[model samples]
Target: MFSSVVAVCIACFLAYIFNQRSREQAGDKNGKPIPGPPSLPILGNLCDIPKSHSWFRFKEWTDHYGPIVRFKIGASEHVIIAEEKIANDLLRERGSHYSSRVFLPMAAEYLSGNMRPLFMPYNDLWRTSRKLMHRLTMPSMANSYQPAQSIESARLLHDLLQDPRNYERWLQRYSGGLIFRIVYGKRVQTGEENYLQRAIKVVHNVERIASPGSYLVDVLPFLRYVPYPLAPFKQEGMRLHSEELDLFRSLLDDARKELETPDVLKRPSFAQTFLEEQEAIGLTFDQGAYVLGSLFEAGTGTTAAAMMSFLLTMTLHPQWQEFLWAELDAVVGDRMPDFEDIPRLPRVRAVIKEVLRWRPVTAGGAPHTLTKDDEYNGFKFAAGTTFHPVQWAIHLDPVLYPDPDQFDPSRWLDPSFPTYKRPLDKFPTLQNFSAFGFGRRICPGMNIAERSLYILTARIAWACKISKAKDSQGVIIDVPSYDYTSGFNVMPKNFAFNLSPRSKLHEQVVEERYRYANNLIYLKPKL
Candidate 1:
């Protein structure tokens, strides 16, 4: 009878708490400012979220609630800002208060202990990570990687020339090479020799697990306590996480060995740069280690997918293909395209922008968690809600780009083409797009990715004609319908294309470069 009374007392306390929260939400004059979506009793709009693609569903809600919409999930409230104008205000203008990541129950509570800097809240540590990235990879400072980009792009061209069936692999190799080389001062060999590939493959598993609603462990944190025998999936995931740590640890050791050599530090890649800079900044060794790892996560995956998109877009649009070749032939000619040639290739840059816009690397960016209560438009966001602004929706906004679904870079050529560029600025580049990210979360490796993408795409288009293959049935294959792999980082679904030298001279040019590039650097993978 005493225990029963205690249970009733507990129920009464929960009821009292819910009543107070409801009263706060209902708005007496003393209540918090802003509008909110219609909420369910306790669970709120939690039931509506996973019913469809959350990003697409959010697009519909954004239409109803303007740029910033207030919605609830479980007991949490969030503000979704779909409008770029508003995003600019909050993400850029109000960065200090607005930059914090929302507290994800599973991400914060169970999966990682929120060790990842991307999920880390805005604090001294987050500031340290941000400062380290700025110190090492600031826009002016990141040019140290240009030489690496050029060498890797040449190797990428040779790889495509040898075996185009796996163009996707080449793109991944280029991205991995850039980041590993940048941070660790270690070169990732092309073809099979890439040690970084092992690291990449492992890191991708973490990405796959963290994608939207991919695991129930992220939702029901209690499930983590389940025994291994009953929960095989958790066991497998735990095994994968262990393997990832081993992989990262191995790279950290590898970087230390290369550091001893001293001669290998050409551009002072991100790791090398940080080791030197962090001492002045008062960052700890653990901070440096995780900073490098976070750079790896931010570096290779999404940018590689974007490169794959460029190749896919080229395969899909023959007109654009023809146009890029014309520019390549006209500007750079028989010689290879370099950094100087990028500015002259306006349409190529526009195409890159449009492709990223169409199928963004992150369908929505890595979720941003709110730090404190704030009003967005008329909506109120609580301190601990995840905000995932859909890049597809933002890129395809009709008001921003008319007839947005189509892939017409020519629209970008419309001198009045309103991009994120400073108003009236003509030249379009990756810098104009938030494809990297917003505010504090902007990709630190963008400089390396941009230079790599520019050099490699220009070379591929210049040296070869990109066209789809024919199956045994003799029907012309389309690139998009071919195959696509999806997770957080999406890419062409393993599509095949034919690669032949534009001329015998082009072939010789590729071969000659390949021979000299033998000294460039490579590491063959073990199976």
Candidate 2:
């Protein structure tokens, strides 16, 4: 009887909070509603929003409502900036008010304990974390990481040669292994470890709960008031929180142990670096652990996803793959491509650029939270409005990219293209425009990601020929359409492909390179 009474009280409190927020959302300070689909009285388009592949729906909204579109889900207002210029003006020029992350109760508070820098609100904690990340990834320091990245790329090639059937697994292992070394000061030899599987699980769980409308507690903040027994979501959040803490803390302890040996300190890992200067940073041990672990979390999945998409694209568009191969043969020869070769092979660089634009790993960039009331043109935005810079819409803009759906590396090569720039090294200039992001909140890992992708993709093309698999009848199977896995970080769906060494000579070259790289172990610094 007591429990029933408490439930009733909680329900009433939630309804009241919802009603108040609804009242606030019903009004527009400019006296005109922002352009959006028709919303119902109380629900405010709650039923209209899809839980997955929301970027596609957002692009459709842009088609009808112009570049800047606004919609309400429940009592919250969401603004999606499709125009590149507007995104620059708001998210870049006025970054002070727009750089904060949207409040995600389940993700930031319950699950991550607000340790993940990307999900953190703009505050002292975020500032400290960002500073550490920036120092790690800044351009001047990016080159130091190449040795580690090169070694891992060699290992990846060796893995692929031995087990081409599990190409996807090898790719994930490569990405995770690179980060494990960078952050934790350890190399993932086999990649078939419990840690890798659990890490993937943690990311998926965060995506499921953090995404808008996935959990009622995030949408209806008052739901947090319910008793633990009544709220399964909260229980699940607590469970995830504990699991993540244990995993990250264990990695941190391992790094700490490495620091005790002077030899390990010479090639300082991210965790070791932070620990050596923990006093100056003013972050607790656990905070440092989570910060480094969060970096690993952000880097691994997206890079792997992009590579998978690259393979899928290769299988579907053999002409492009052949073109890349022709360039590789002419420029790189039998040698694996490295950082020095980036400038010499513009076509190879263009292919990587087009791949990122065509199938962005995170289609909708992280939601930008507004800290204060703002006005754009004549439209007035409330203080708490959450903005989503929809990469799908922006990358597919017909005016910027003609026939945007088609994969054409030639567009980047053409001097006439609006977004075209010379010297692929300066491609996607951090500030003005990029697949990485916009403004103060742009991904600090951009430099690292670009470098790593170039090395891995170029070397893969140089060493192998990616094509569609064959059936028993010696007929080529049709490549699957661009169907992707569902979540915030979209990857190509499982597809059949034939990844083969380009030649017996190339296979021998990979083995020799791997043997040489394996013998020279370096402490791969985190960026």
Candidate 3:
């Protein structure tokens, strides 16, 4: 009762304070030189943090600040880029200059301990790590995984049809299974008692610890001076770190043992790629473990998150779902979508494009570090400044995507629309989505991710009638799209929906293709 009263009081106080600032700065007022929100005390707009999601917070600031908003998160200063053109200018044109990741003290010591790339500082180590990711994720190199990507997609369709209620789990299974197979020539049939979940759970534990208030050790480094008992986060972080070391190293050890038998090392994955180049790269066994672990964290979570978002969107936006189904029906008919089929499908491609835009996996894309002092528009960014991609704000910008909140693929459908570009994997593609990141830090798994989405989305829409399950009153409860979880990976929290076979031929097409594709994946877990 006391805590509730205090919380209410605090909310009232903050609302009162913010309203005064909001009113005064509602319009082009004192005319601050740069476009941004009005500051209040040491916190600035930091006190006006958004609840539910980061996108809304970013939008709030963008509305108040314009395209380029400068703000503070604790002592650190960050520049949020909202406009698409400006975002491209910063993330693409100046990506290399701003590709370095900030030294997250909380993550480095507690989460990765130099075992992951997401938090690793930009240097020769990161560059080498980036090279390894490129071998699998870069478009040209990514083509090598088409066999694995396609097979996994077929498995995704098979599993979903069997247990539609477990669609969310199945999506993760497909992504996790594909990553495992690609990395070690193994498959993940289930997430429970499954190496993928155990490993990913550790990553999730680490993500939870790194939340803004997860530990004060992040904001105030002085806390590190305190003893372990005094700093609870340090203790927790170290415990999580140990778990990470055990999980990733255990997986690598299993793969290494398996490599002794068949042509395991010959497999195409970040792990195998790194192993082949380990001698030349000069990465120690421990470092190699972390690098592969980073791939697991980066590779598995984000892609699965996007897929869940895709499912949610399809359920909510029935018209777009219908259009995609019609497109799939017309284009592929009863056949499964393969790598070659990607280019031929335009409307399906547009759906992918819209998903990346409408409900992106990451709200504010991975923060970028400025390598050199440079000028963008009139503002000069100093070296070491971590620039935010602001994907959440940019995707919702009115100038580019009018009524940004609306789930409208028609924006891309209309050729007259200025922001309309070619669909991904061909001319315009998913790689362009800032969510995977930019320049030096672009996701290396983009190709495989695209192929995975294409195969499953094409098959799902072609085979199943995915509609929202209505409640007792016949209300369209399932149709209302849901949002991502509170965690770093933006996933559809959870929902129940109805699904059915699109046609008689659809089942045969799925069965024939899945049987052929299923045999291609080989899981090799120790007894």
Give the number of colliding residue pairs in candidate 1.
Answer: 18
* Candidate 3 wrongly placed segments (more than 4 Å): 1-32, 38-45, 50-52, 210-213, 261-270, 422-428, 472-479, 521-527
Models 1 onward score TM values of: 0.84, 0.94, 0.87
lDDT of 2 by residue, 177-292 (tens): 87777777777878878887777777777766766678766666666777888778778888999998999898888778877866544445788788889999888988887888
Q: Model 1: per-residue lDDT, tens digit, 1-527?
A: 56545544554455446544744654423334544468665446666766324666677777676666666653444667676676677676767766787554344433343556766788897887777776666666556567667777778888888888878788888877777776776766653664676677756765666665555444333344555555555566656646655655566656556657756644345555555555786766555666777787777887788878877877777678787878788887888777778888876777787888877877656566656666654445555556666675677688988787778887767756555342323367777367777776677777666766667677777888877889889888766632555566667677767778899888888878777766764332111
CA lDDT of each candidate?
0.67, 0.80, 0.69
Evaluated at residue 78, the lDDT of candidate 1 is 61
Residue 120 error for model 2, in Å? 1.2
Off by over 4 Å in 2: 1-26, 261-267, 423-433, 523-527
User: Per-residue lDDT of 100-133 in model 3, one digit per residue for the tens?
Assistant: 8766767886667875777777788878777766
Worst 10 contiguous positions by lDDT, candidate 3:
22-31
In model 2, residue pairs whose N, Cα or C atoms come closer than 3 Å (at least 3 residues apart or on different chains), thus clashing, are none
In terms of TM-score, how similar is model 1 to the real structure? 0.84
Ordered from best to worst TM-score, the candidate numbers read 2, 3, 1
Question: Looking at candidate 1, what is the lDDT of residue 66?
Answer: 64
Ranking of models by lDDT: 2, 3, 1
